[model samples]
Target: MSNERAKILIVDDDAMNRVVLSDLLSDEYDIIEAKDGDEAIGILETTAKDITLVLLDMIMPGRDGLGVLEVMNEKGWIKGTPVVMISAETSTPQVERAFSLGVTDFIYRPFDQMVVQNRVRNTIGLYLKQMQLSELVTDKIYERTRNSDMLISILSHIVEFRNGESGQHVLHIKKITDILLRALLKRTKEYKITEEEIGTIATASSMHDIGKITIPDEILNKPGKLTKEEFDIMKQHSMNGAKMLDAIQFFKNEPLMKFAYDICRWHHERWDGRGYPDGLKGDEIPISAQVVSVADVYDALTSERCYKKAFSHEKALEMIRNNECGVFNPLLLECLGDVADTLPKELNDQRTSKLSDADFEKIARSIFESTENDTENIIYEQYLTEHKKSQFFASLQHGVTFEYTYEPSMLKLHARNAKALSFPTTMAEPENNSEFWTIFGRENWDEFAKLLHDPQLNNDSFSFNSEMLVKGKKCPCKIKVQQCWNRRDPENPELISVYGCVEFFK
Candidate 1:
C-alpha cells in the first residue's frame, strides 16, 4: 500500500474498527492494517517500505505493541518513522510504557472521529516539519564540516611549507584517495555516489591527518621511526581527528565525514587487529581506514622523514606487498599496485621546493623594472609624468616579456613572455559581471597565464587587477621594440604581437 502517497499502517484486532479507519483515511492516505500486534509486526518486517506513520493498537494477542516497538528501535529506521499508538488499554502504566518505547502519541479507544482525523493530520504535519528542519540543520553542518576539512588542508600545507616540505604530502594523499574511492565503488558498488558526493568526499579528505595537530612538531617532523611513547601519541591523531570532525553535526553522517572518521580513527588499526587504539581485525575495521591505512603508511614510508631517508618507491611498495602488516584491504593493495606502475619520479622529486620570499621578491623586481622602463621615453612635455603618480602605465618600449610556467599542483604563477604584467586590486567589486575572471578570458585557456595576460579593452588599470597585463594594444606608429625608453607608452604601445609590447626592467 506504500507509494508516492502518504502511507499509514493500522494494527487493531477488531475487523469493523479497521473498516471505519480504512473508509475515513483511505481517500487521502495509502493504508495497511493487521488483525493483531503479531500480524502487524509481520507486515512491518516484510513490507514497511515508504511507510510514513503507524497507527498502532497498544494491546493485542501474541505480541503486544510494546514488543513491536522494541523491534523497531533495534532496526534504527524508527528514528525516521513516526508511530502513534491507539487502543482501549490506555491505563496510566500502559500509556507510560508506550511512550517510553518511543510511541509518538497515545489515543484511547471510543475515539471521536473528528479528533482522530485532526490528530493524524497534525502528527503527519509535525513529522514533515521535523524532517525538513533536520535536513536544513544537516546541510548547514555539512557545509561547516567541508569548510573545516579545507581549513585543515590549508593549515597542513602551511606546516609543511614552514618545514621546507612543499605540498607533496597533500597532493599525494589527494591523488591516492581519489584512486581508492573510485576503485572501491567499482568493485563493490556499496553505495550510490554522484559527482557532488565525490566533491564533498575530496574536500573532507583534507582533514584525514588533522589529528597531527596534537603531535609535537619535533616528533612530527623527526622523519624517523617514532619512539614508543612518541608513536603512541602520534597514533592518537586519528582518534583526535575523528573527535574534531565529530564535533560538527553535519559531518556526523556524511560520506566524507565517514571517510575522515575512518582515517582519523582506524587508519592505525591492524589487519591482524594488532595495530593500535583498538585493533580491529581485517574487514572488521572501517573500510575508510583500511583504504587510507595503506595510503598513509605508503606516503610516510616513501617520504623523507628526519629520522629516516626517503625509501625508494619501488622498495616501499615491495615492503608493503611482501609484509603481512595487514594494514590495507587486500583489494586496495592490488589497486595501489596498479597506480604504482605509473607513479612518476617527478612526484618523488617534488617532495621539497616551495615558493619563498626570494620568489616573491623576483616578482616585485619585475614590477619595478616594468615601472622604470615606462618613464624612460615619456615626453614630460606631452604629459606631466608623475613618475610614481603614473604607476599603472606600462613601459612597453623596455617592457621585458615575462614567460611563466605554473606548476599545476602548487597553484602559484610564474611570469615570462609577457611585458609589464601587473595585477591591481579593486576596492569596488564588478557591478554587472560575475565573469570578472574575464581579465584572463571567458573562453578556452590551456594555461592560467593566457587568460591573466589576455587584455580587456573595456576596462583600464584603475578599474581592476591589471597586474598581469600590458598597458594597452600596439601604438598607431608601430614603434619598434627597441625604439623607446624612459617614456610611458602611449594609449597603444608598439605591438610585436597581438599580446606583445616592448618592456624594460630595473
Candidate 2:
C-alpha cells in the first residue's frame, strides 16, 4: 500500500456490483475490477503483492467468493491482504465459511453507504498501522546495532593502538569468529544460533583483548616469559575490561554489553578448567566466550608477538586441533577444521591489509590535527567576532584607543579623537620599550616603566592623569592600560601586549 492510497480489488460477477463498489472507493483507493472468481484469482496471482484489500461478492455465477478465499489462503496472500465478502445471499453457512476462510468483513446488497465506507477505512487503517509499527521496530534495531558497532570499534582501536598491535588484530578476530560461527550453525543444531546472534558474537569477539589497555607496556610486550607476579597482573585485563564496560550506565543489561563483558572476562577460560579469572570447565563457559576464545587464540598464534615469531597457518591450526593452547569445545574445533583451509586466506588478506605503525601514526595524527585545527579555528573566529564588537563599541568613545606590543615596542593607533594626541602613522614608531618611554616626561615615564615591570602588578592595570610630551610640549593627559598575557604558555610571564585609551586630562 502506498502512502498516498491503498489498492483495492473489487470482484463481482455482475457489472453493476463492481460499478457500485468502484464508485464508492475509487476516490480514496486505486480500484481494479475482476468479474468472477477465476478473473480475481488471475489478478491476485499476478498482482496480489501490492493489493491491500479484496472486495469479493459471495454469490457469483462461477467460482464465487468462498472459492476465491480458499485460493487466497493456499497462495499465502491472506496474511498481507485483507478480504471483505459481499453477499446478497443472507444464508448463515456461506458467511460462516467466509469468516473461517479469513474474510475481514462482510457487506450485504443494498449496502449502507456510511457502513461500507467506515469498514473499508478502518480495515485499511489497521493494516497500515501494523505495517508502520513493524518498520519502526526494524529501524530502531538497525540504529542500535550501528551505535553498538561504532562504540566497540572506537574502544577496540584504543586497545590495539596502546598495545602496539596492528590495527587489523581486532578485525581479524571478528572475521574468524564470523566464519567459525556460520560453520557451526550449518554443521550442527546443538548451538541455537540465529543470524542476529552470529553478528553479536562476531562484533563482541573484537573486544576480547580490550583489557590489554590496562596492562603495562613492559609486561604486555615482554620478550620473555613473564614472572609469576607479572603474569598475575597481566591476567587482570579480562576483569578490567569487564569492569570498564560495566561502568558505562547506558550498557547496563544490554545484550551486546553482556556478550562483550563475557568475551572480555572469560575468553581465557578453558574447557578442562585451567584458565584464569574464574576458570569454568566444559559448557560452563558462555557460547560467546567459547567462540571468541578460539578466534583470539588463532590470531595470537598467527600474529607476531615480541616473544615469538608468527607461526605458519598450518602450524597454528595444528596446534589448536592438538589442544596445545588449551582445551576448547569439540564442536567448535570441528567447525574450525571444516573452515581451516579458508582461514589462512582470510588471515593473509588481513595481514596484507595491515597498516604499518608509522603510517597508522601519521594517519591518526592527521585526523587529530585536523580536528584540533578546526576547533581552534572556531575559537579564534569567535574571539575575532567578539574583539570586533568590542572595538566597534570602543570606537564610539571620545578618546584615542591604541594597542602596544611590549616585546617589539610597537604602537598601533586604533582611533584618534583629538589633535593633541596625534602621531604620524607613516613614520616608524619607537623601536623598543626604552625609546617609547622617551615620549613622556622623564619622571612620569620612569614611574610607568616601573609599573609595567612589577611582577605583582603583572595583570593589574591603572589609570592616572599624567603630563604627556607631544612635539616636545608637555600637556596633561589621562591614560588607561592593561597588560595582555600570553595564553599558550601562561607560566612564562611575558607581557604580550597592552591596550589603552588616552585623552586630554581637562
TM-score of each: 0.39, 0.58
Question: RMSD for each model, in Å, please?
Answer: 18.5, 18.7
Put down candidate 1 lDDT per residue, 442-496, tens digits, no spaces.
Answer: 3323342343344442122211222222344322212111111122355654312
lDDT of 2 by residue, 237-329 (tens): 999888766655444678778888889899999999998799899888988899889999998898876567889888999999999999999
Q: Which candidate has the highest TM-score of all?
A: 2
TM-score of predicted structure 2: 0.58
Kindly give the stretch of ten consecutive residues in candidate 2 with the minimal lDDT sum: 361-370
